[model samples]
Target: MDACSPVLVVGALLLVLLGASAPTVSAARAFFVFGDSLVDNGNNNYLMTTARADAPPYGIDFPTHMPTGRFSNGLNIPDIISTSPACLLSHLGEYLGAEPALPYLSPYMRGENLLVGANFASAGVGILNDTGVQFVNIIRIAQQLQNFQDYQRRLAAYIGEDAARERVSQSLVLITLGGNDFVNNYYLVPFSARSQQFEIHDYVPFIISEYKKVLARLYELGARRVIVTGTGMIGCVPAELALHSLDGSCAPDLTRAADLFNPQLERMLTELNGEVGHDDVFIAANTNRVSFDFMFNPQQYGFATAKIACCGQGPYNGIGLCTPASNVCANRDVYAYWDAFHPTERANRIIVANFMHGTTDHISPMNLSTILAMDNTRN
Candidate 1:
């Protein structure tokens, strides 16, 4: 079943809310991003890591036709979310002004541009410090939080301490992590340290506990509204399908891992919201089930098959990194995946569109569109 019905079920509510007049920004909302490659724009480009995606065929669909270190052929989820009209940033763009958040590592990140926001996401890092140790030089989640602290310090120097704290408090935060913890850590080398230390039953809870610390740190950093994304369809990705499936079926074990993780993530967020004494502060996005719709029923989403990647080689073209030497597909929009593990830009757009408007379990409590609309309406 298509988890995101393009047609809004609550049409009357949408019409009433979306039809409202725009609000003046007392302060422009900043956006901060943290996580793995799914949301990493170009932070990995500055790092000396093989996990980098700055190459041809990786950004063939991008406007520049050159890689910007995004894993997708064009835009990634954060790009879509920031550029969408449903985002508070876009509304603020009208007068208060808006610009794409700068990569935290960029030297160009100084001055007024800091007001927009900053992307601290690294391609290979995860919730655990050791999750993607293979990709040396990438920033871990703990380090990302420290970097956020440093960012606030610099912003305070630019504006003032009080204004900087206020900007961060009103900012929209996006974080995507758990996928790498599973794909790059537990299942990384077979008999990886994490898997050896804890069985699946015990392992997941440990991850959730560690994740709580990360979220708490984010809140402490003055982030008031955060979109905490669950993992994607881990088992259904072309890489996992190629390695585990002889019949092009989603890998059951990994699927079970994701199924185990996502719900726990949702419940944890619910509990965290209660603990914070606010219902909307930590919104959970059920990305795993949402992506499963396109993966399992590719044609319905205009994809020929989710099992084959648009770039790379071997079974399903999913064996290794997508280089210029890889077999590039003619039509990117019809392929669910861009490389072995990452989704195509087209696929990312669809997933983000759902994030903007998807209802019920797809995006718990409320979706991004509703959140932004209501934020504007109340102001």
Candidate 2:
């Protein structure tokens, strides 16, 4: 996240409509990040949190079968961003003090030493202050920024202040979260039990207010170019389907929750862009979709297996997790879901392509063209 100023807030974006020219080139390079499990490759190794991926079967698909603290079987978004040349930062001989012959969870300091950026996203984190207070000390948005500052200081020490500043300014700031906020807080545990006592409308607004603090902090901390991914149609997860007896039918309540959150989040971006007087610094990546309107009719979605996951039997039906009696699917590509909650690596790849291309219907930046046009708008 870099810095933004007052430029595109008050309809200054209308320049394109008037056949105006865009900026020359953006000055960012270091993709500093902060969020939950989706973007977290490691970094949490230093923290004593229960929501850890420093175990087996997590990185089964990764190169050399290395478990790099990612919850997935392979590289997550941060790694994808680092794939580019200039943004490519080494994960050895720096963050960990020195490269080691064997990689282990205790020495997670390896990847954090990269120049592209480090991921501070932890699993089970939420926008609200106390969503999973007892389960583990998840990194909240505020705390995530604190870590980002520390990252900045370390980078400055190693590469010098000016270079570090330029790297951060030019690089993308990727922040993916909001799933745990709804799932763990409003739906599970203390909140779920308490939700019955409160109106969902009342509860959601309270959550949004706290989320605002996170955004404000990022903008203040000089995170100019940001990709804030909004929550998707989460009600479709196998666990939720099982819990609510949904039978592959979308939980309208959950859909309503997404509807409530996405638009408000967009407006927050607009207001923040205005508040800071900058162009579209905050682009909301929409992750909600039913894959060609098929999931709505489940029959139309064309899977006889929507109700039960291809992996487990009772609840999540996911085989790959650290479950004792997991059901591993032979062919994972056919199934839309990989685990109870997340999509398959293939699905995520497609989604990332969509996130970059902005072609999918659910979460384009206003429209894909709007984003394409903004590429020319940089100055």
Please report the candidate that would top lDDT against the real structure: 1
lDDT tens digits by residue: candidate 2, 1-379: 2112123321222331232342311222445667777777665655687776766555655543556577665556555543422111231112111111111112322333335355667766878766666557667777788877777787788778997776676556768767777777777654475487557777667666777778878877677778777886777666667666534566567667777876777777777777878746777777765432324444443444544554455665732244425665666555556556655554565556566555535553454335535643763
Model 1, 39-148: lDDT tens per residue? 99899899899889998877787544668889999878877776422233332223213445668997677776577788999998989999899999998999899999
Residue pairs with backbone overlap in model 1? none
List the candidate 1 regions with Cα displacement exceeding 4 Å: 1-27, 84-97
Reference-based lDDT, residue 254, model 2 = 69
In angstroms, the error of model 2 at 184 is 0.5
| True-vs-predicted CA distance for residue 95, candidate 1, Å | 14
RMSD of each: 8.3, 11.8
* Cα misplacement distance, residue 107 of candidate 1 (Å): 0.9
